[model samples]
Target chain A: MTLKLKLHTKPEVPLEADCICPDRMQSLNMTEIGDLVTYHGNRQVPLKNFFECSGEFDGEIDIEGDLVNVKHIGSTMSFGKITVSGNVGVHIGAAMSGGEIIVEGDASDWVGPEMYGGRITIKGNAGHMVGSGYRGSTVGMQGGEIIVHGNVKNETGHVMRRGLIVVAGNSGDFTGVNMLAGTIIVLGEMGIRTGAGMRRGSIICQTKSELLPTFTRSCDYLPLFLRHYFKHLESLGLIISDSLINSPFERWCGDSIELNRGEILLYAGK
Target chain B: MKIKSTTIVDTFAEAFNMYVSRVIITADSKEWAIAAAQSITGFATSVIGCKCEAGIETIIDPNDSPDLRPGVSVLIFAMDAESLGKRLIERIGQCVMTCPTTACYNGLAGGSPVIVGGKLRYFGDGHQISKVIDGLKLWRIPVMDGEFLVDDRFNIQEAVGGGNLLILGKDQKVTLKAASAATKAMGKLTDIILPFPNGVVRSGSKVGSKYKKMIASTNDAYCPTLRGVVEKSELDDGINSVLEIVVDGLTLKAVENAMRVGLMAAIKPGIKKISAGNYGGGLGQHHIHLLKLGF
Candidate 1:
């Protein structure tokens, strides 16, 4: 069973819908869910006022219509799945500990911010700070996976302590910035200063790009470790071309100004 | 009972409970895969001196392999998980790890995990990387010919070993032919392996030796040359040679199935009698009663 929600009335002011997670809806009846209060700007209003909710769900929730003003849709949901069929507002899936969130359309800023477990798959573009730590916090995305099939804006995986972030399209500047540990794979063009303060973890760029001056060239050879990740990526339905699988890579080990254990691997062609 | 004019012996094959693990080794081609398998299974005929018993289980197609390469599955058996883990690490490290374009994987996935590549990954120095696919951890170690991908652990389970069928023939040539046919048939049975040299043992032994220093000695009772001097001989007057096929399998059913196949293959002309070896129920706990199998 899935709990279905449709926005009957679009709020002019952004709604802080942090309570929209499946964990909160699994126990409430339709009337009880209607009574659950959500903040619209500074005013508190019951969810039934703006959204029509139905379905007897067991561990899954589906939201329809444009949720561009809905914030924190699946935040802190430790279990179950939340699927958004349209564009979602800021803080979507923020601080989620478990379960999966799949977005079929574009997502706003702070997507999956500080998410620690489960997986989040965005089929469309994502705004800035996806999987990044909140300002003043040193850790981000301590665990879990974030896969964005489309372009991503700045500071993706910023201060990420652990987990994987894969961007299929171009990424804005400072991708994997301040990463303490984890892996970031950008299949397309990457912006400048990638892995700027990464102490450990790997950043793989398929496209030809220049690295930061702080990273020193380690070697030009085929790494055996990539096959393990490639096999995993393939299982996720990501196609890893023969050229990339058999290609020799130029390994640059750095963020030397930090722990010096982080590496940036760029394809150098076969 | 007579089958194909050969007499079926009324006896049982005593077998011991053992720990076994199966490993799948794949390579760029069948040749390389079988080479790695042969090397890993070599010198592992018995636990008496070799410390383990191992053999090639089957050849797998490239499409079925983890890396999409031609592969070979091998079964290795020891007395316990600790010994099995040690032998797997040592053999895979020296044989498969050194073989060209070879990758090792655990064939059994769901039992108690025994460490394999988890320990071998250190050979990569600092370049080794680990990835979890479908919740199974695999390690990639940087090698000269690309990378060596190995599963982190292999499942181990209790199994049966030393299940045997003895062929007594009119002559050495007849015994060899019968044993060859029996081995050929038993090879088709899954989850079992004939671990002896050529999958046939000529130097079968008894429980104890006449010498005080040796724990086991040759079975003089079945030796045609010692027929006259021995206290008792199990062989008939025309029987000049005896060949034994020992089966080690993942379960008692597997060993019994293999023994049935072997007996069917060996019960033919030129073979006078078919029997099994046992130390009067004193050796092993698990017994494969040849007559009770009704094959």
Candidate 2:
């Protein structure tokens, strides 16, 4: 039978399960799939104390619960699909490498951080640092994609190395700050200091941008390749749609500190 | 079948296997787009002479193309997939990429897939950016005028080449005029393109060379010279000049349309007779019977 871990009740002290990414558990042939995991007196506690667990060993696992205070719900999982029906805590899919994880609700800060590859989708607002590097670290998301339907907190992509991050709503301050490379597209008006001190990569904004002084103003023209690229992305079931991203733009290049070559394309004025 | 006393051949116009690619160049206006397309598609008539064949496929409306500007689709073909790929890279990199207000896009959707943007991204000097929209990846290479956006990859497909006809005219002037008229008429047809210099060639060649080292030589059978030496001349008594138009297509129907339109226009005042060159059906597996088509 397919194993299931059900959280029938709420928890205290914001439970921290650091090694709980969906990418890691997809391959587990757990004979004891119903093990209740929790914390007790500063150490790890049995999950049976709070939730009722059921079923036998199987490749698939269903995690059902209101994990609002449960941090690191699915940090890295590979191969199987994990569906979280309710809101989650911090570091939701940190450093994920593979498999598919779906959070039916909001995710706390650092969701899918340093993700090498995999797919993480949140149907609600995502916390700050959606795909950023660890504090004091240089590299950010190298690969993978995160789609957030709601608002995002600040510093969404600090020092990102690769991959795509699409936000359908407002992006808070410091979005794509010092980004080394990769793409961070915001459908709404960009907050101040967008792409501040960036070196390489692209930050496509649907709304006019509030540029940082470091980035030099570049010419305005229709970039032919961008149009076809948008077309390709649309066919991939990504959030990129013609009506939203297909429009004229003002180009800018700068953050010369790294001898910067990255580009920032702000939406054209109506 | 017959129309206005003109014969509609019951036999089909057969074509040969070829590799094809579609290129879309976008410009500030339709005029410039047309210009760029014309420039790139020039000197492409037939693989036998020019080594490739190409033509403008369609006029793209402003809102319909990339950059929200006017654009046109160009179809190019080569004898094989490798040659098609090589020619595409050369033409796009040299012509479209260098041209102002023009961005190149791939038209054909699938074949031995490769990356164009991934190769051209080196121009960015490590600053090129890639954006994924709807699963399509695009690279933005930093250029002097902001950035040049190009698709990372384009699709390729199998096509047909050497679908052609030879027009016999009274003299050089009349022969050129008829070739021009035929080209004009064939231009209206879609999915098929005539890639060559002015879509016409006077030096049409035959299967083999007279010397041991050569593979192809001039088609003496259609030559006005050596009238007695060349026993089977398709040209009539007054015919002095011959011009060939090669067609490339996505399908047999596409090639047929070009043949019908081009031959009808070529058969006007200065022309004597129209025919195709084939090695007793040996050169290719498929054949186009001129006599049956003229019936």
Which consecutive 10 residues in model 1 chain B have the weakest lDDT in total? B128-137
> What would the per-residue lDDT of candidate 2 be over residues B1-295, giving only the tens digit for each residue?
4343333333333468887888888887778788889878877766765677788888888777765678899998878877777787777776777676677776666666657777787878976767665456777777776567677886678877777887777898988898899998888777888776667878787778869876788888788995778767665678788888888888766776678788778766756666676666655655766554442
DockQ of each: 0.41, 0.37
DockQ-based CAPRI category assigned to the predicted complex of candidate 1:
acceptable
In CAPRI terms, model 2 is classed as acceptable
TM-scores across all candidates? 0.92, 0.79
RMSD (CA, Å), candidate 1 to true, equals 2.6
lDDT of 2 by residue, A15-129 (tens): 7664344444344444333343545437676566555656643555566888878876666655555677888888877787766678888888998888877777888898889
Off by over 4 Å in 1: A218-228, B124-127, B143-146, B292-294
A66, model 2: CA deviation in Å?
A: 2.9
**Cα lDDT for residue B176, candidate 1:** 95
* Each model's lDDT: 0.88, 0.73
Task: In model 2, state the lDDT of residue A165.
Answer: 84
